[model samples]
Target: MASASLKAPPLPFLRAIAWLRDGMYALHRRMVPGHIALLELATAGYLSQATCAAAELGIADALAEGPRQPADLAAAVGANEDALRRLMRLLISAGVFAQRRDGAYELTGMSQALCSDAPVTLRDLLLFFGADLHRKHWTHLSGSVRSGGSLWPELEGMEFFEFADKHPEAGEIFDRAMTSVSSLSNEPLQAAFDFGRFGSIVDVGGGRGSLLVDILQRHPSMRGTVFDLPRVREGLEEELRMPGLTGRLTFEPGSFFDSVPKGADAYLLKHILHDWSDEDAERILRTIRAAMESEARLLIIEMVMPQHHRPHPGKIIDLEMLIQTPGGRERTQTEFGNLLSRSGFVLTGVTATAAPDCVIEAHPAW
Candidate 1:
């Protein structure tokens, strides 16, 4: 029986087969590390979608107090117990949640961001991005890329702002998201720039007065105005009620395309110019120019697009502009200089902040 088994294969033949198997195993070992990274990258969209689902279900809010079993959580949120358990497993692995030894889940620091009462809650922001309309429009991103135009008009039968105006719920979420994002940028701006030098500053297109309110609070000597369309200016009374903001910060309702309030030493265009085409941006700039004195400064607070070799948040946001706005885009230094010159201002300097955004200073061309 031992001789019969030994005769099954020649020694050289068996060695050749073993060698081939070893070579294949070696190739697999080498390829697996790279393949794992690529797989994670390729499947990243699923993670985002899952996160949106969790936010929509208010899982963070449910887990606010303590850990809970998957069944209890599913019952609380009206989700499928098994499916929610699976989702929680993935989330726990992703660092959004933590799994306990007892098979319950708890909120981690990352999941705290989705809690409704968190200082800077991003729940609404997640919901807004994962909303049906936004997701539907994103499906046409390829169309936008090919046409060099946005899918906003085609998707909603109007511009994004028009759509938001028509939908109060979406508008509220969008406004809240903007406020959350702006609040994050406000501190870096306060640290980087000296707003105390300007007697008065007008925040053109300031929505809900968050940034202006923050600025006025930071600079006791500076009085500020928050200017935007009537719809955007609505409900800002609550925002203006901050302790020292009574007489310091005020609202000015109007359109940037038409006119911005005059007589302010500095006009602030925070995250504004990136929302329109060159023609529209120039028109808005001209309106500000008409309202400004030769010595008045234009402080544009936005992300300065960097060179293409490295990664930048502005570059990703520029693609967002392409998806939502007709010709809106983040600009490089040269682009900013050109736009400022055409709009009757000189690009004086760009001050970097701890945040990715910068304070681009310009003076009216005398």
Candidate 2:
């Protein structure tokens, strides 16, 4: 009887309990930033998937003109309205889009970045990595760690480059991604290192020749060459026609594993050495060493792995290399110095760039 008259435990008591629980959660979130940050990191894959979907459907491009209802977006992209709305809801929560009071969705600054026509487009990277061939590699990341190498070749029955070569479309996507990413770093690299002293510079394994073009543009008196695979040369027509690059920049098609163009005062290997194991990296350096004169300099532009345990982009990219290439890993400064010594070169200096990469200057020891 007394228990039956409890009166739902008093509504205010229940409300207080709810408030206390919420306060505890808020306090935890405020106090333990790392805990909340890790929670966000755990969901990073899902966020990438959402971004991939948005990029594939050209959602940002569709909304570029203005805001649109979920129904309209679905119709424009040929998707189911409800499903699109749900996806947009997730993206909106991720700060990619904003929902109007009327239920229409509009692009945010971040979302605008996904547009294909954006000045610096990451659309190709998103689309490339989101594709089945590339995305599936991440599934075996743990196995790659256990095996001390990449599991991508094992899963695909072919190396990544082989697969890319076999699939021209995939190769195109890869090249476009490389071009887009390289474009972002080129300006920073140009600003970071002075190219004035070198009479001639060769961009080894330079994709699309963007870096060299940017370099030669800044140092008009300097001659430059883009040395890469034959396929890379084929893609450089437009780049060759650019105002400053027309007659100054030349193309040399070949493999760096075999040889590089000779007689350049400086040989620039931007983001190249990290793609190989120590043995392979040494071999590439030796080959370059043979091609270079005693006074010639090797400018190796790459992410120098930091010594401290802090949030560094190189650390994450190193993991990606581990998952993608069997022997690829970012090197520390000491590691670079030792590698150079083994390859008949001396690491003269390492200069930080405006970007995440560093310019590691080495000269032939012999």
Candidate 3:
């Protein structure tokens, strides 16, 4: 079976492609009638909703075996035949699925990613994005923008983590979505950094230990621990059972705000600091710093937002943090350096990974 992996070109080549893609977009905007282009932009939300609907209805899964007539697909997924046909037609226009002359629909490359068994399935991520709670959060985007804060606390009467704790189903979907995202970054991380240098590593706030498992599997001699909340331990049994990890990988249950596991050769914080404000991020960092030996390294994996106005995924994700989490935002390299200094660590080096995230290395300053 195929596994999710990153096969990106070198960074310079990728940047060149990005520049070309941006130029094409600009040229299209100039060539198309202004009103028509603006209309398409305005209607973009419709496409998002339609794609979410397709994922929710399992349209891609039903067609996984082969092409199927619209009526047959509707029956398989328990949807209205005419409505399913219309939805499939919209998706076809968007290049998600295709229809044959015989009136049967088949998966396009885009739709195939929605299949549960795909090499890099995005179905869980789509479902989480389209979940009712997420939609509600986005509806309050204006409030967050105006206040320069998240609306999650105001709407849910608690912080995002607490809300997740109380709602098991929502939490499960979020965890699954995060794991899917981790899969996308796994190979890129292995290629970008030297995890083998550390004899032992601890993944702070590492839900279910997905990244750590991938790393330990790559470096057979390296030992790894996943430190997360007690609830996250529920999923550890399955990962622990993965072949060749019987003794090399383990999970430790706790909160980073309190403390992290001590004295590992390296401490990895992947996508963890982005969930907090500078002050709170420092608290978590200080806690980790206190637990670390002077020689130990700290590895923070996150998107380093570009200082300029170039297009980056982190720019959009920063908005998501604004609406979803209190005092959370993606940081620039300088911002990261300042934050590490404040937390008693010196920014050492940064390695750009093939994925959107970059590996930032730091050491205790004092």
Candidate 4:
């Protein structure tokens, strides 16, 4: 479990950092020749691939003991010594790894996070993003843009979720990636919001019940349910076996498009709505609305895009949604309010967490 203090910095502090970072980038652009700056931007994909390669070869894990010569690292991770050395040099330049004067490579702060045993590992998340499936989908970004829709279903002849369902290996990587990503936000989310108010909560579309587990761990007396597809229930028995969650946590496999469990104090939807378009998202909201009592709250956990759009990670994730899902998108506060209104609910409040996600609370209109 992640520490409670892993929350995001204050918004004002973050804004200052972003301004400084952007200023530095602007300074670099001004200092460099036009073509040099353009070339740097163009070659960013190579860096991404290099990082992915390092991760796949377990280079960080290999260096976990201490700095090792390229020959030793190559042998440990089964790579060509010369090629591995070149890769390490590039990563070192990018501040991922460091090359000591002794001619050995070691993990940098960035690379340390890539190690499997790190306090918070992004190794799985990197693998998932760098996977061929995601790479192939990104290649169709232009087509999606032109069509004003997702190219995934058209290209693959199936929806993204369906493809994941059909391919177990791919599904496992995706699930692990989501869980890994969730770890970054879970602690911050708990710290920002008050889940203790809800004695009974249902995590709608909750895969593997990780969020619910986190919540249950905090609120001991709070009973929780993980409502997702039947396939999601596969390894949930293991989740149920966790120390404090034995009786308080339960798995209820079902589709949010159809219905959610009824009469819970709150319905949680973390990272769920962003994977769907307005129509489908509305259907999901309406389904939950039908299941909820008048007092029940709908807690939507997602990246609420900035209306003005200065610089937010959600902006980048929106592109991923565009190329991958059929009409899925990150919504703005106004857009969310409208969506909730259409789904027979009123937007109550929006609470920003330490993570990029915001808790958009809504209640049934009537």
Candidate 5:
């Protein structure tokens, strides 16, 4: 007779968990190289921030033509030579500056981006997001996770916008940061969608009107209106008045929560809805829906999260929303479908922009 032998059946739950674990681990392993780069870049904030300060102080601009000794550079910026040398040393290691045999410092490619004279200076964006506002407010990220609320008010003793309004420097920094981000999306979006079909485009909650300007500039046939709070309108007006964009763009100071100016062929809300909760988002969407001109299409430019286990960068950006906004995070296509339906619009499809974000297009219900 054969001795009794034991056999085991597979556990589905255990199998599923194992699969998930392996997937996430594989992703992490693959991401490790990029992760290392990001970590090194981020940890060198001293160099980054100092570079911003130098840009603000015209250090890079001063070094544009040639290298300069520490003594001369520091004197120009009103700093001590020894201390300035130390700062330059840090930046040199980060590849922003190069050291010469004579102890002078010269600019590098990355340093060029930090220069105020550069056609596109990330200087303003870096100085704003990398310093006081980010430093103080980012500290409350843990609090945001614990309560699912904004850390701005708790950290700054006032809401984010309010604090920015009261502090002009902060406001400028905030506006510059927003403008920089919007500029990145503008061209990609212009190429992705045809604005020539629409006569009037309304940009709801448009900040600085950078994207609006880009779209109008690209599609000369289109005229646009920017709708936002008075403060944001101020920033928009600032951009609109700069010679070229004047006649092409108009500014309407109002709230998205109230009403978006009607009579537009398309209603554009880029980077807006994600700042609000489902309830508030629906409210805003309904307001826009009610005001939509007959035959108007609604385009929402936003980051879309993947519905399945597939990895996407929006997951990290969702955490940024969690820490900064009250009740906002990225959502999937199906979730957006429901959101659009609740607001009286049916999502037709998504347009992939040249930028990393996607434009979800919907039409008002007939």
Candidate 6:
């Protein structure tokens, strides 16, 4: 509140200027995300509920062949035609689906990715992330904001992994979601870095061998192994039987907190460290240090926080991790370098990938 003595008197023209200024500010306030988010929050419930129905009824997968009218899609998925049409109308207006003038509803690119039958779909992510309890858990995000602790146990009375272990269906969905996330990461990361130099590579905490298989395919001469919990080996073995990579890959079941199998010329960890705190990351790095051969190099494929953030998505993801897990977020190069140094590794170099991620490499410290 400016005092009357401090406030400048306005000319008639200046009053118009003030009016314009306030009007523009009011417009901005109305258009900004928070205003949009209030709308989005209302719509999010519809989207999540619709997604659950789609996953349950396999609507997305069935629609992949082409556009279909509501009655046809409903018949294929064993859903009610009028109810399906109503839901599709909402999704169409939201840009998740498209409608022809002929009254046929079609899947858009975004909706296509939500289909499980698609070659590289994130259907699993869409389904699991939109599951009722997951959304409910996020609704209590303020609890996480105030306490800076894990929300899974608070939400479900079980730790995240513990709940997943008990619910096999949810566990399968969790694993599938991780594997499918590589759908977005694959082309950008695989094309950006060259694997010709490393004869053997180890994927730390590689889930289900999806990424390992892709990497091995790109470099046929290179041998690869995926290390994850014992439960992951079945999927890895199934991946081994895939046409091109059977003989060149293996699966190792072990905890990264313990010693990793260390003879590979290169160790790859994608999206791993961000899930843990600095102390935990260092503990894992120390295990890698003890087991890795003297010549082995380490690669961390992750999002690096930019200096002087204007607005980076990784910052949001960092906050999300802070709420959902023990860790805070992606780090700047300096932050990662500091961790490497403290964990007996030397930062060799960093390479930015074509995607919004980068590869930070290191080796055993002298």
Give the winner by TM-score.
3
My TM-score estimates for the predictions, one after another, are: 0.86, 0.85, 0.96, 0.94, 0.79, 0.85
Model 1: lowest-lDDT 10 consecutive positions: 1-10
Error of 1 at 156 (Å): 2.2
Candidate 5 lDDT over residue span 33-79, tens digit each: 98786786677656556776676677777888788888888887788
- Residue 268 accuracy (lDDT) in model 1: 92
Candidate 2: segments with Cα more than 4 A from true spot? 1-39, 100-104
lDDT-wise, the better of 4 and 5 is 4
Candidate 4 off by > 4 Å: 1-7
Candidate 4 residue-wise lDDT, 1-366, digit = tens = 433335567767866788898788778889999999999999999999899888888999999999998788899999999888888888999999999989999888899878887766788889988888899989888898899888876788998988888988988888878877877787778878999999999999888776788888878899999998888887677888778878888998778888889999999999999999999999999999999999999999999998763567999999988887878999999999999999999999999876788899999998
Cα deviation at 199, candidate 1, in Å, is 2.5
Candidate 5 lowest-lDDT run of ten: 1-10
Over the full model, what C-alpha lDDT does candidate 5 score relative to the true structure?
Answer: 0.75
Clash number for each model: 0, 0, 0, 0, 0, 0
Residue-by-residue lDDT tens digits, candidate 3, 1-366? 123554656778877888899888888989999999999999988889899888899989999999999889999999999898888888999999999999999999899989988877889888988888898888898999899998776788998888888999888998888877777777778877998999999999999777788888878899999999999988788778778888888889889999889989999999999999999999999999999999999999999998776678999899989988879999999999999999999999999977899999999997
Regions of candidate 3 where Cα sits further than 4 Å from its true position: 1-6
Clashing pairs in 3: none
Candidate 3 overall Cα lDDT vs. reference? 0.89
Instruction: Output the better candidate (5/6) by TM-score.
Output: 6
Which prediction has the highest lDDT against the true structure? Answer: 3
Where in model 1 is the C-alpha error above 4 Å?
A: 1-38
- lDDT of every model, 2 decimals: 0.83, 0.82, 0.89, 0.87, 0.75, 0.77
* Shift in Å, residue 240, candidate 2: 1.8
Query: What is the Å distance of residue 210 in model 1 from its true position?
Result: 1.8
Q: Each model's RMSD to truth, in Å?
A: 15.2, 13.5, 1.6, 1.8, 12.9, 11.8
lDDT of 2 at 186: 64
Write down the lDDT that model 6 would get: 0.77
TM-score comparison, 3 vs 4, better candidate = 3
Q: Of models 1 and 2, which has the larger lDDT?
A: 1
Alpha-carbon deviation at 191 in model 5, angstroms = 2.8
- Candidate 2 positional error at 70, Å: 3.3
CA deviation > 4 Å runs, candidate 6: 1-56, 308-311
